[model samples]
Target chain A: MIQTLEQISTIAEMRVHIKEARRQGKTIGMVPTMGYLHEGHLSLARAAKENCDVVVMSIFVNPLQFGPNEDFERYPRDIERDRELARSAGVDFLFTPEVSEMYPKPMLTNVSVSHVTELLCGKSRPGHFDGVATVVTKLFQIVQPDYAFFGQKDAQQVAVVSQMVADLSMPVQIVPCPIVREADGLAMSSRNVYLTPEEREEALVLSRSLKQAEAWLYEGVALRDIQERMIAMISEMPLAAIEYVEVLRYPDLVPVEQPTPGESIIVALAVRFGKTRLIDNLITSI
Target chain B: MIQTLEQISTIAEMRVHIKEARRQGKTIGMVPTMGYLHEGHLSLARAAKENCDVVVMSIFVNPLQFGPNEDFERYPRDIERDRELARSAGVDFLFTPEVSEMYPKPMLTNVSVSHVTELLCGKSRPGHFDGVATVVTKLFQIVQPDYAFFGQKDAQQVAVVSQMVADLSMPVQIVPCPIVREADGLAMSSRNVYLTPEEREEALVLSRSLKQAEAWLYEGVALRDIQERMIAMISEMPLAAIEYVEVLRYPDLVPVEQPTPGESIIVALAVRFGKTRLIDNLITSI
Candidate 1:
């Protein structure tokens, strides 16, 4: 059964929806998305449904996170399709606010982390994480969720949000789920739809390279050697334009030379499949 | 009836205190203070007690806010005295965590605000607001207050915190209470105890200048004329070295060239009474 909201246009409206849900003694779980729904998002919704009484999925293709040259306009968005998928995933509430509604005017405020934000995806995209941090913060406030779910596809983003929650002492708990992948082992992402048949095949290198690195690490390969091998393999792919490839501490996402035993390490990368950017990561205790 | 919480040295212990209070269905209000409590802090504590079922006052002289040359070491410390003052003011809990306890080893996170933090007190004391923002963010997380009380003594601080809450969408409401003053109109502060007899007399000029500005504004004087008069008055007090005397929009605390009706204006000043620096403000709707 599909439930449709009146399309909340302001933070106040969103609050009214959450307030009513809370009055029913319902726990809210939020899944914030940029609006092109796929299995990855559905997986998050299912998790939210299992953990919370009411699940709210926010479809806002946040413009603040995109640079001038980045695909803010061309970003994949299908509200009707997303709504149908969310309904099937057992999502109780769907919040799709307009860009103007989210950012009524040019915003003067921004949330930023010092060192962690300057690495990985942040190294290439200047204000990208700042944009992500700002929007997620706004969503957290609007939804007032008990728990927020984010797919591991954007590992750096998950790490960034975790750090933000810890640093700012935001009350919401960030639940980072495992990466949802396709049959070919490629991470499920809306950008995957942007790939041509040829580019789609080339995008496989992202996950494959990380898997290879993991195998090498298990076989006693050093951290620097593993990263060098992964970079070489991705560089060899014709359609895979590597943006960044690094090994960092999981959760904190800080660059580390060697992983300590019991410490989680994230081997992550961002690659361009045609004009679309795809990110993937492999987490393991080293 | 004075109630004293045994000094909790860990975040876990502090959370237990908060959780136990909540289990009993008590709403928490927090007053984050650096020890060496004065009338100003007691006023905030009283406000917190009136507003919340449980008042948890944290007394930690945050080192991060102090510059290297600043007197962080010599600032002050009278936790026993502070506990008495808080208990007398009807506080339910007093959290006095050591710096090491609050900032356990391997602390790498900091919170900062842009634009708003770059002016006023932030201008003279670099990274000062960042320290305040970071520690306050931690306190908000640790105590999880329904309402937090701050004094108008630190005018720019109230402005920075208000902006932080709006920007981060923090769940807590920030209450800015009126500045408590001495019979001679000198703003009461923890640092007031550091003032010598001669310096204490000169400190009266800070409030006197503000009163002078208020009288001029009441007489239908322009903002510029009032500022010029106050600046001249402050300059005459030899021991009262002026840092800044500017008028700004109230609450939002934005600097304004012309006053607007219905919008509040704050005439704030920071001056040195001997080696001790003091700040004060008078907030009024124009």
Candidate 2:
């Protein structure tokens, strides 16, 4: 039997519950997501459940993170389905605040991380990471969680958040979980549902190119050579339009001319299959 | 008898103490300041003492808030003197993190309040509020105070911080204390020490002009006329070089043509007496 999960729609109510739990010596964990739960999101929830006495899962389809022409309106959301899944995953409280609830007035405040945000999805989407950073900062304050879980599917996001936590001296610990994947090896994303059958087939190259890049790294190939090959292979796909295929130093996202021994490297890629965009990455050390 | 206040210079050490205080159910109040404690700062600490079980005062002159041409190096510092003052004021902890301790790395993350920071001292100091907001944010995270205190002398700063707290849903209450002043009616500031004795006497015009402005408001003067009159009064002082003298809506700092019966208005001014710049303001309800 699925347990009934408590749903909180306002930050005030969630804070009260969190405060009570905190007073009772219960360790709190949080998972912040833009709804439409996938295996990747569930993995984060499971991690929170395993580690925390109380787990809070917030499903806010943040409009701030999307660009003017991007998928803000079309971002997938299923509240009932999310509620059931969160209950099954042992979320003690599911905070689902409306856009108005989160942003009661015009938000003049912004939290942004430079350098780390200038590349990857941040480059393609202006003000995206600033929105993500601001909302995540708000959630961190609202939830006041001891630990927060995030999937490594968005490696750059994890890096940005980690930098923020370190820079701000925020008390919460960031736990980056491994990316979950489909049976066909495509990285699980909420946007994956937007892909057509043929588009989905074409999108698999994102993950495939990362795998190829990883193999090249193991074979002692140069970083530039691996990036070129990955781009070449992905470009061969009729529908794939490459956004960026980069091999950079991990966490910092600085350009790495050559990977040194024991230094971590991330081979990340973003591509568009027709109108739908997909991203995938692999982390390895030389 | 003066009690010895614990001085914390590192974020990690501060957090340990804050966490323990929190666990003990002691309400924490913080007074963040740029050292060289004056009556203004002590007033905030005393207010914290009155309201909280534990009072933590931080005395770091944040370099981030200082512009290239600003007096970062000569800001002011007397650790031993500040310690005695804080102890006498009933502060439990006095955080005095060094520049290196507070900013071990070049901070890439910035917290900014946009529209609110476009005027007043924020206008004169280009990245001033961003630096203030960012450092205050870091301190809030480190101290996790139940209440943070600020003096209304820095009225725009109070407004910016209040806006950030409300917008981000930070769980700390911002308590704005009444402006503390010298017997001569000069606003207490660390930088007041920078003034020569002659300049100090000339600085009296700032408060006097503000008084004139307040009187004009009561006599049914238009906002513009009152502002112009205040400017003219300050300009009469041979030593006073006015940077700005204006009347605007309180907190939001938007322009006001005329004061409505219930509207709060702020008559704020910034001026230079030789090389020393000073700011003073008065808040009044029409």
Tens digit of lDDT per residue, candidate 2, span A100-179?
99999999999999999999999999999999999999999999999999989899999999999999989999999999
Model 1 chain A: weakest 10-residue lDDT segment is: A1-10
Residue A239 C-alpha lDDT in model 2:
88
Displacement of residue A132 (Cα, Å) in model 2 is: 0.4
Overall local distance difference test of candidate 1: 0.82
In candidate 1, the second chain superimposes onto the true chain B with a TM-score of: 0.95
Q: Which candidate ranks first by lDDT, i.e. highest?
A: 2
TM-score of decoy 1: 0.90
lDDT of 1 by residue, B121-238 (tens): 8888898988898889778877878799998888788888888777655668999998889899988888888999989988888888888888887777888888888988888878
Give me the runs in candidate 1 sitting further than 4 Å from their true place: A1-10, A16-28, A249-263, B1-9, B20-26, B105-107, B252-255
* Candidate 1 lDDT over residue span A89-172, tens digit each: 888778887887776655656667656777888888998988898888778867878899999888888888887777655668
Per-residue alpha-carbon lDDT of model 2 for B90-174, expressed as tens digits? 9999999988988899898999999888888988999999999999999999999999999999999999999999999999999
lDDT of each: 0.82, 0.92
Checking candidate 2 for backbone clashes, the offending pairs are none
